[model samples]
Target: MAMTLSTPPVPADWTRHTPFSDPGRHAELLEDVAPSPEAIGPVVRNLLAHYRAEGVNMPVSSRDDINLRWVEEMLSVDQERHPGRSLQDPRATEARLQGCCRDHTLLSVSILRGQGIPARSRVGFADYFVPGWHSDHVVAELHDGERWRRFDPEVAPESGLLPDPWDLEVGPGAPFTTAAEAYRALRAGELDAASYGVAPDHELSGDAFVLTEVFWELAHRYGDELLLWDGWGAIPAPEEEMSEDLLALLDEVAEQLIAADAGDKDAEQALHALYVRDDRLHPGERVLRFSPLGDGPVAVDLRRGEDAVTRPGIP
Candidate 1:
């Protein structure tokens, strides 16, 4: 029962809607990539089965806590097997049932659909820290009478509203280009609470998204050449080590933020805290150090400002 409808794509309108503003609207302006209704269904059933096998129950209502518990458990299971690939995209699907954030969303959508409820996938920058250089999030929308309901599989109702994906409170505002840009701005103090907006009761694990990004950078840059172990190879580091990179990236981003203001003193000072003095601003756990160019006993701290921190292997 999937039909392509023509409508202006408005992804960030956080308020839920039913039957869509336009019944024929299919291509959401916010959706860079969309899944076929058919594609979405199987993904959901697979997730349900996967979790059900592990003894998880579906949410009876829009209980954030229950949903979040499911999300955490799902991620934990996936992390145990595929630690490096935990995102909210279907592209990261490893098995019929297992997937990243996107996959989870798709699964949620399917569950809603199975109940004869029309649901759609919403993709956007989520401020909550998971693991990566950027924030990407997925959630399901259900049309319940007049207004649609916003449901987050990743957010636990009990945990409350996770941090706004960009720390911007939930409301209508000018849309930003990418989540990374939004995050960089927030980090640099460019976007104030008033500008970016906010979300209610949102929670995040800073290490998850930050570390994922760092590990990805390392893998791309040094893994193939095996520079870390004298050509031995680059194995994906742990979560804490990966988050350490967030500090490094944040430092650079902070400088960029200052530069955006034409060398504003405040921005420059902020950058100084991160770049100069090599203070371990956010020192991550110290892991077995390895040289990027060659074999050497170098301490690697994924945390920002750690002297051991080096440039990421990839952009």
Candidate 2:
């Protein structure tokens, strides 16, 4: 008989989290998150048709020209959607026409990377014409002839100034203190995945500090599901159990990191505090209120609670 949910076997390779380590195996596993390019052909065609109809010339010579033309030709100035509402897939680029600003830009990065172009993912807050409230953003950068040129997969003409990675201001403070500080800043709402020019594409855990790179891969697959957790294992869950398997998976990751001495002393200490001890973990039956912002992404503010620890103070 076919395997059913009642007798579900834990997947074999949650332990391995590498990017396309085995292209064949990865392709098989990613069937759920990424669509095949062939299936997306129609979408790409439509995007290209739209651009052509508008008389916007798409260029593909040097990376810079290609990036510039992509920005200028593909995207419109009408800002209707927030960045987070739209869904993304690795294979969306396979569509002949490309997608809206974000879709096309992500595809552009994938295509350039496929062609062996040296590229890097950028993520952080975006402040274009909009102001004050920071929005999460992602993009790609390529080394054109002499210098590196920034590219946005989301914009048509691809015109926007990406602040220096260290220069980004999330809310009250500079979100990241170091290059890898993004891992922490994300939870505090100080830094966003897009600010790094790469979509985070996953929710993550605090214990993830140990196998940082590996965690990034896993989180990417389930961008919205992973939570910022401290410990691992099938312990008594503080919140409604989303998936016991996921909890167990995190436990396994924590064990691996602790064994490997993955993160810094603070991270190690935090992990221990969260799992081995229960005091650091939030107690059950406490309501944490977040104020719904009328304008930007939901700004979180602590209304009142005895269990509330540190309010994610957004300055």
Candidate 3:
């Protein structure tokens, strides 16, 4: 009779904000930033510019519809491209903000949860850019009050490809992998679900894009910090098909997200009670997205209450 669990909010309660990492009114542009990924990873790689790896040449209508899911609309489009500057200066990689790597991990988890620090965002599958593939990534974990590090604010420690892009080493020949550890290593065939995705000649990728990246790694670990091509609840539409009870409910959600990333508070309260009683695992009020700038599959509408200002495939 061993069953009685309910204590799961710790990790400094992720410092706060998760309507896609808030930062409203630009939260004073992360008030003097510095919760440390060596000062929030080069201010999120100089306020983002990786629309497709560093040598950013801009304009395919400005890096194809960058789905900026609120970090106050990516600091209001980086204050309309460097207006009052100083998100710690140094712009000019095509004046920044084109985004990818999940907008450099949701603006470095919204400046480390606006400096109170807890942080989040994981999604996963990196294998260092693309030699034998495994692309699909998104980093930032934070919580350094004594654990959870795993950074890579879109890799830039002179791109030696992480010996410590601020402490990475995720597991099994490490270089990150958590779409529930690449869906339990592609159901234990031990890897090669079409070499993992979105790059090695991008036609999306295999094992149903690692089962929609394990429902985008539990909707960015329960916070609903979405947009890794945002689809909604129970996420299965790239011509939907996987069913053997949805691959045994994503193999018990990739074994409780790898035992709640190895700390396992009853596997993080059974993955927060199966992501709040599973409405196909969370994300209601509309989702569909898919636009890698082509703006095809829209739907969006996430309520947008408090006088919402626009975030449906951000043109």
Is 2 or 3 the stronger prediction by lDDT? 3
Descending-TM-score candidate ranking: 3, 2, 1
- Give per-candidate clash totals: 46, 35, 1
TM-score for candidate 1, please give it: 0.27
Residue 76 shift from truth in candidate 1, angstroms:
20
lDDT ranking from best candidate downward: 3, 1, 2
Predicted candidate 3 versus true structure: per-residue lDDT over 70-169, tens digit per residue: 7787888878877887788898787777878887787887776666666788887888877888788888887665568888887878878777888887
Model 1 — which ten-residue stretch has the worst lDDT? 219-228
Cα shift from native, residue 46, model 1 (Å):
11
> What TM-score would you give candidate 2 relative to the actual structure?
0.28
lDDT of 3: 0.75
Candidate 2 per-residue lDDT over residues 63-110, each given as its tens digit: 121111222222221111112121232222222232223334333433
Which ranges of candidate 1 are over 4 A from the true structure? Answer: 1-97, 130-134, 160-169, 172-315
lDDT of each: 0.34, 0.30, 0.75
